[model samples]
Target: MASSNYEVIRLKRDLPAQGVVIHQITDDRMKTGVPLHDALDRLLEAVKGKVLLVHYAKIERDFLEAATKRFYGKSLPFLMVDTMQIERRRLERTHQSIQSNQLRLAYLCQQYQLSK
Candidate 1:
């Protein structure tokens, strides 16, 4: 087992992330060519007290849990913050006349002047 650590990450969606890519932000590393299990080991080490900021966390959460179970024979616990879900709630609470589809990652990022 590796020593415990903490890091923030934004999993790349433009590319296939599972079994293809995982970005380790602390070191600014884009790791590839490694097995997903090994990659997740690095991620899990830093899972403590951190909420993963995922674009679409509902789907991402299911995918991560399934992949973790498949690769490690057990699923690990982690927190996630879905930007899309939060944006949808914000629109509803603010009574903004916005379509649900407009809660997409690109639109939210653009509205907030963020690079996606």
Candidate 2:
């Protein structure tokens, strides 16, 4: 299932385990036969050997694993990079303050002037 927080999704795909994406999975799409589970299946199959990048790693890691088990009776072979966690670690190492919710994607991007 998708998160309620994101209004749209944009998935990119490469080789199996390389990378795969499914963005903008709206309700209409689900009704049109692209069930959430099916969308996730496509993602899992596509990212067979790839590292997935996300703003927060925990959500995708925890949720996708649970969903994979529930729907496929197994685990998802997921390799992920959490930019937020990386930033947090970097800040901690430098003895810098986390600054409220600066770990959020938007905030971090704004702080560093990233286009994303």
Best by lDDT: 2
**Could you tell me the C-alpha RMSD of candidate 1 in Å?**
7.7
* TM-score of each model, paired residue for residue: 0.64, 0.65
Question: Which residue pairs clash in candidate 2?
Answer: 9-23, 9-24, 10-23, 11-21, 11-22, 12-21, 17-47, 17-48, 17-49, 17-50
Q: How accurate is candidate 2 locally (lDDT)?
A: 0.67
Name the top TM-score candidate.
2
lDDT of 1 by residue, 18-68 (tens): 434333233224332445666677777666667787777868788788878
Badly placed stretches (over 4 Å) of model 2 are: 1-33
Predicted candidate 2 versus true structure: per-residue lDDT over 1-116, tens digit per residue: 22222222222322233222233344443344544576786776666677787878878888788878988898767888789889989999999987887787778889889756
Error of 2 at 10 (Å): 16
Reference-based TM-score, model 1: 0.64
